[model samples]
Target: MTARHVLLLTAAAYASDPDGPWVDGGLVLRAAARAGLGPSALDAAERAGLERSPDGRLRLPGRRAVYEAAHPARRRAAHRLLAEAALGERLRPAGLLHRALAAPYPDSALGTELAAAARLPGPSHGERATALAHAAGLAADPEVRAGRFVAAADQARLAGRPHRARELLGRIDELTPTDAVRGAAALVRGLLALRDGPMADARASLLLAARLCPGERALDARLAAAEAAWALGDALAYQEAVAGQLSGAATARAFGLGMAAALDDRYAAGRVTLRRVVADAAGAGAPDALLRAGAAALVAGDVEAACRLGSRALAAARALDARPELPRALELLAYGELRAGRHARARTHAEEGLRAARAAGQRNVLAHQHAILALVASLDSDADTVARHAAAAQDIAARHGLVQAATLAQWALARADLARGRAAEAAARLGPLVRPGPRQGHFAVRMLAVPCFVEAAVSAGDLGAARAAVAEFNVWADRGYDPQAGALLARCQALLSAGDPVRADARFTEALARHERAGGDFERARTAELHGEWLRRARRPARARVLLRDALVAFERCGASVWAVRTAAELRATGDAPSHPEAPGRLSELTPQQLRIAHCVADGATNREVASRLSVSPRTVDHHLRNVFAQLGVRSRVELARLVDRAEATRAL
Candidate 1:
């Protein structure tokens, strides 16, 4: 075998002696002998100082820098071996134990051990780490210097300075070079790339690391590469990278699994994984795992848990003062609040999140944050705010290919149009989104917007489109959504039957009941407005009057101007003035239906004649006229005529 192979075998054997000095050259010669090196090679190793001859016998170097720069497992083995020979022994006991036991047993053993112990060096980790650190300063050998650089890079990475870690790792080849050292450099570079981004290039570095690493170091590189694959959204790479991690930190691994599931839109699996990630004392986690967990909770419809986790994540981010992570934490927290119907608080969080994202130059997060703000504005019926933010968000999302954000912005803009009475324009904008497609996996997002889309369709007289939207939504509801989403689904169904007056009334009742079960005041108010409009169109003036008034109150309370104004108009059409609303009993106060009956009586038509013309029974017509006469304080048809004449004469005057 070549000298390098013998030296490698020697290092492996040195690392394998679980009970021996962690890094002893004398033990290495024995280990080389174990690898089949002959006495002559051992002598050569001794003369070459690889098996350092301190006195008459070969021994390991007293310093800890000897094997400290090797691959991770090897470095670990070296440190562990040093630790086993604790207190930084000046001399190794492995060789002496043998030499003493070889002599006259009891008599020579104690003396040999005593001499060995007397010559022992400091073997504590602090002492060895200190010695190894100083040795790097004095290291003139390129390989030795490279090892020291690797050691420093390890510390830098652990300390969270990716830039400094990169700087140290970059010098491996210039200092002490090996394919293994180069692999070590590559692994650190890949990890740094992941933590700080431009994640596109991380895969290449991690691939290089996995390829060049000699042993278990490949496992570390491959696992990190999987995470890089997830960040880049590369499915094939994620599969390969994930397949390599047979074992590791369970929580960290679960976090990775959760992220992969979330990317694939497998919410059930993702939620399960997230639960594992945050279970108090479970697996180890990265700094951002909490935020990821919170996001998963939000998507799974666990709003309360999502909000709690988000708060915790933001607090953790603040504690660390990690500017890059703050925006995502805030964004997640805002989403939770939005789901919980805390609109004002959600707006505040989203605005702050947007500012942080902009300052951090996080374009992806900035796009999502802007979408969030637009959605909040849309809820408040603030058309101007919705238009501005939705436009900005859509532009960035389109450029970045952030399909989710782009679609959400479209939803906000379309809803704004619907609120403003541009139903045709709203339906036109939302048509493509309501249908089933590749984007349909974003069930909740689409589900939330479908009600608005259905409204637009009904108002635009696109019954077919409205029906299709309701059908598509039914599929989602069947698969299951949260109760709030179920409420929205019911609301959409009610809107679909807008032309069928009886069915619309029944469905509107069902929908409002569902909303009450789910508890979103905004949705309840919006549904009320729709039901009132339907009732007014059906000529159920008494029912319409009550619903419209209640709806107006709700809309105003929720700050929904457009719906409030529309409800007011409907109230006026129900024969109640918007401002005064026809208090108790007043002259000339009559429903459209009642006024028609009054005119029929004023024309001197018999009740039978009036019933024939008005498509009602004579008794019904007589009864309506009696009520109209009572309202005007007139007892008979001729008296009603006199009252009508007086109203006409007053207008003429």
Candidate 2:
């Protein structure tokens, strides 16, 4: 069928029945637009008030007019015209009649006609007979009601209402003789078993359904069997069972398979398949599909894509008044922003999502949101706040058996401890997280673990262990899974510990670059402190003092009190402490050169451009900037920029 025809039919279906078989109207519109539908068609639809609802359900004011205009008979002709317009199909009365017969209807003749019109080559003849019998209220034919119950159960399951599906299936089973309907009962029982987490029973029941029914009735039964096999850790069996099942073509089933692959660490395969599902969903404008796609993007490290998809999902959910899915979309958006280094945006969305989840009594969502907040707090160097949020997340996860979330919370707690300089405590706290190897998405946890181990090794002066940890981290980094600024910073520290000043300086510079790229001002400040210490050890005391001072100022500005104090102590030891004791707290104490450099950097001008604007040679600008860096004790130009990005961000609070 033409894309336009598909979209029109989809729209008509949604308009005729808001709660219908097809759940995503937005996807259909997108597909139609992509297929080169003129703006006039969309504008006409819009004028008809079809696009007002975000969920894509039509809301036409003149329903009678719409019904008269798009009657089934007329629709059949329109479909023929559309096929000719888009597919170059030749008109045939038999074809038109066949298509018309396939259309869904309340009566047997219409249903039969539509089926014949659509050329649906299935044992639907039996289904049609059963439907006719049931509609005639034939008392002797028990299979008629059984067919109706099965159809209703299938619809409920497709709509994500598993409980309703189970209820209907139960009624169907009770109404039929046990021996006669054993296969149908087994299929329904299998689906219910899967939902209730009894994979073994689900697998057995579905196996029986596949054996007894062996045809159309076994489609869902086989898929359920595969899912149960997957859940039971029988990967080969699951893959074999779902390889050619009808349900395997479904988006939800594909998404489930992708998730299973991801859990198995087959990221490349998972990413490709998930992205396909996402693309299809996006094309169809499916909110749930968009939400799933956003999650997949996150797993693939496409934070920007995740953010966009997640926002779209949130809007779709809100339009549909789907309160349950709103927080999920919002949380995904918040995490995407956080990963993309949009801290203020992340914080705002996270807070909103948290409030919504809490209000809805969604403890699992609340816990995940809390964990995200804790990560943000850690980035801001709010150790106490991070600890509190992490503790709360841990408690919630533990109470609810959220093992994956609990692991992340534990990692966050370790981060808080490390921020407070309690390396030993952090290492101890993170031990379980590392040993368990994660039940889901272990990359983030593994990233955090390496830093904790390195921190403990460094604090105890175990250079060998530190080196080993850095090597292990390098493996992950090489594979492009590095999760934090600390990984690069740790590498720099290891280089410094190994007494390779040249490479250590180079690594430190790289770490500074990474921090700047990530917009991690706090880490940038810490990098500057390390660089300053390196310079001091190399007897470049003059330069060391300059970077150290900048680092201290930036740290204090970012609310990193511990690092600020440490940088200040380093400055004093180098005999290059600020001339004014209160200078760190007072912005005006900064020299003109420092202020000028800060302002230019914050404006995102390159150093050479800053030089041109300030009427200085690039070298002179670099020298002065280096002096500014030393005087302010900052690491890179990016950190300087972040320090001066906003008054509040840089202010000593």
Candidate 3:
């Protein structure tokens, strides 16, 4: 055969089921050989770089253009040859699947066999059979096709393939399915919408699912409806959705009630309910139930339990290959790590979760991960990274009506402003978010940002506004809603009392005492810096130097570079430099993405190679490389390589 024929035959093997990410190399060769192409077809395609993917799987490198370019008659012949080869006495499931896929028309006999195969219990069988059923146009028998498609859609949704799930559901819609089958498909669609949303559409689909679905699925739909209502910021609707879950004993429903109570500020009741929910979910060993309880634990201020539950949920999800739940588990873990002041671990989890969320098409989860990454950047005082991540998050949140994600992104932006000494701007940006009005942010999130707002208002000389915010924060602190609440509240009070030296001195002392008990290094350092600055202004240089030195050390430990520079300046003003100031890492100034790109480029990889490795567009790699060059002050790839080598060598010291 000619080279063109070899390529077309190989392309036809993959085009037969183009939805999958990869086709087995052996399967491709066998199918092509059966199509009158020699076994040398694989060798020729490999030589042409058509099988150039590092995984050795058969897929068109740049879209399916090569397969689409083939003549229609040739493609059908190739599929028929594969189907003919699959007809054996003791047929394996894989061979049987090929036969079903090559059906010339909507053969009801072939449809029945594939539908039965789909109903067989296995991890991948259902998805494969249903995809083949639809791709082969097997909807002539509605009874066989409808049930199979509905189950496949649910499996796709659970596996975190939202687009695939929707495609299957759309196929089901073309058939005359029974009410139950249609309701089942709607349930999966609603769940998919909740993950990749327009909250309004998710709520509508879920309500329909609840009305038409039966038993457990109805309960599941109602529970998801409650979450969608909460995300939309409709308090009345949230309550109604929660009321609908009252009749169910599902562990997820218990989790929903606990989350609602916590959001309502009944932390004690919420914690109690969530504790039982966690135990029940653990006994049931359901990944989804574990995620619901884990999220509730985070909201209840039980960070330790939340982390534990998150770890368990992640393990279970991976073991069962539950793709949709994986990102949710990671989000819970990242949030817990952030609350506990494990900034490095939090950033790691957020980055991994961001990638998984992208793959799963979980838009809401992606927004949440972006917001978390922004918060991590804020702690590092990296304003540009903060702005970039926050912008990405807010863009998604606005489109999806995700109040919590939007609130978190706004808080990150305001915090970045404060770090850059734009106190007035920060205060202006955060005031409406913290205060109650139509433009106010989510209740739980806005409350967490109150300390930042108070600090900004105080810095901008708006003492009256600062005082009111501090008073409200004091109530939350009294309730013990956060482990670091006492320290943050004391710091806020000290800021408001700065004009009264004696009162301010007392509050500063109280803040430092509370800081000794708090977990967050960055927050503790901020309090110390404020106290030291006040002492220096009071002409108490001796005491100021001591506090300033400690603050500088704490800031450096937490990688808060901006805060470290300011604290170092304060220490010098008090006649003391940061006495053992450690030398910074050579690549310390680079953002995570820039660092990755620089390392890749330094390793002698071309831009295209780096882009493929990172699963990003070449243009994105080029854009980040420009910023990396500017930041590192390297004029060419050669200088960048030298700089990276020296940095690596210095780290070895």
lDDT of 1 by residue, 30-80 (tens): 445444666677656545555543553333442224444345554443333
Q: Compute the lDDT of residue 254 as modeled in candidate 1.
A: 69
Whole-model Cα lDDT of every candidate shown, in order: 0.62, 0.58, 0.74
Candidate 2 lDDT at 38 equals 56
Candidates 1 and 2, the one with greater TM-score: 1
> Which residue pairs in model 3 clash with each other?
none
Residue-level lDDT of model 2, residues 83-193, one tens digit each, is 233211221212333233334443454434332322233222222222222332222346655655555454444333445566656656546544436676678667655
How far is each candidate from the true structure, as Cα RMSD in Å?
22.2, 14.3, 9.0
Q: Which sections of candidate 2 miss by over 4 Å?
A: 1-284, 379-384, 435-444, 462-465, 482-498, 516-523, 533-653
lDDT tens readout by residue for model 3, 213-264: 8887788888888778877766667657766445566666777677667656
Question: Which structure among the candidates has the greatest TM-score?
Answer: 3
Superposed by TM-score, candidate 2 places the C-alpha of residue 597 at a distance from the truth, in angstroms, of 35
Candidate 1 residues lying further than 4 Å off, grouped into runs, are 1-246, 252-287, 438-444, 578-653
TM-score of 1: 0.56
Question: Clash number for every model?
Answer: 16, 26, 0
